[model samples]
Target: MKYFFFFLFCLLIGIISLTAQSLHFGYDISGNQELRILQYDDDSQSIPLPLNPEPVIIIPVPDGPIMYTATNGLEIYPNPVETELIIKWDTQIANLLVKIELSAYNAKLIEEVKFRASDQKAVLSMSQRPSGVYYVKIYCSDGRIINHSIIKK
Candidate 1:
């Protein structure tokens, strides 16, 4: 009877541990099957696994309104710029009021300017700013807001 009770206690513990474990399966470089069962204790740190070449595909189906550009002639140049940033748009959108904002990575506002859009071009100086990543947000009068990421060196 004592032996039967000891066996039962061990079986219960095994079942509990199995229920608390996480299992992952993948193929190794040699085309062999790899199974990983991990259990984390308070002192153990978890490390991320390397990305698999064949990953699961997730297709996004948007449920809300989708915003798209009405015109395709918008252009910006000299990415990773040092001194100046140029913006040019379609001639059809000329003379519209545009609110241009330059912001840091943390959404902190740095400079804001309002300009009348011209098909020719508009130049913005970046010589005074330090080297970092910045975002330029252009808000058009037709409710279109475009965002461009720029790096200043």
Candidate 2:
């Protein structure tokens, strides 16, 4: 008789254990899965949160914005000069072809620099030209030209 009662008790214990579930506070033990559960104190169980608010799901891929400008200004530094001069410009140009031509009585090319349309600035090097009166011609890709007279002491 005692042996029959023991067998029934073991069977009941197994059934209870098979029905009970192991839970986690903030995470899930299952691998390769992401679970977000919400618990209510009134109910002694947990339920999954809404997967996504919108019924028709759509996700956007991140992408960068477009950037471009044009150039319309120039700056020549340190008049009454020396061996070298620094040239800068205020530009609102985008993806432009730039050429800086230095000329005197007999025109000679001084320096040339190139910039992408996105870059509106450049630094020119002119350390080798002799001290004399010179002309700087700035040419744009769109057939626009600017000229300036500079003196080197």
Candidate 3:
């Protein structure tokens, strides 16, 4: 009787595990397996506070909205500029005329570059600039504008 109960318990456990696996993973008619992944919506997009001393910059994926901007297809890098600053955008906005302006903390315009974003990238030379707070303003032909702060070391 003891051995029969043990065997029954083992079988029950096995069936429970198989049921849980089928609930979590799907099998197709052709015997192909597919996993259902959990997805979060745009409103839940946020950066978590860093646990380390180093700062973290969360770059939104192509599907998610860009930070601090309504537009979705732009990328900037190296916030604490050392030599050069690079700005890039999606090809969808490549034909739009883009005006990139760099300014000082006091709202003084420093340098401006106007061109078609078809090139997909803009490189600004900051090697000659003084180390201080600065701003980068990008204006798109679609009437979208984004301003970002850059710290020069």
lDDT of 3 by residue, 97-143 (tens): 45888899998999996555668888989999999999888766666
Clashing pairs in 1: none
Which candidate gets the maximum lDDT versus the true structure?
Answer: 3
lDDT tens digits by residue: candidate 1, 16-103: 8876655565678997666444545445665445444576799774343222243556667678989988877777656553677889
lDDT ranking from best candidate downward: 3, 1, 2
Kindly give the stretch of ten consecutive residues in candidate 2 with the minimal lDDT sum: 61-70
The TM-scores, one per candidate, come to: 0.50, 0.41, 0.51
Model 3 segments beyond 4 Å from truth? 1-71
Error of 3 at 55 (Å): 52
Q: In order, what lDDT does every prediction score?
A: 0.71, 0.58, 0.72
Model 2, 19: alpha-carbon shift in Å? 99
Cα lDDT for residue 116, candidate 3: 54
Writing each residue's lDDT as its tens digit, candidate 2 over 23-129 gives 33344476423556765545487877644534566776333322112244455555655665555554444433367666774667655545443454444444666
In candidate 1 the C-alpha lDDT for residue 2 amounts to 100
Task: Arrange candidates, best TM-score first.
Answer: 3, 1, 2
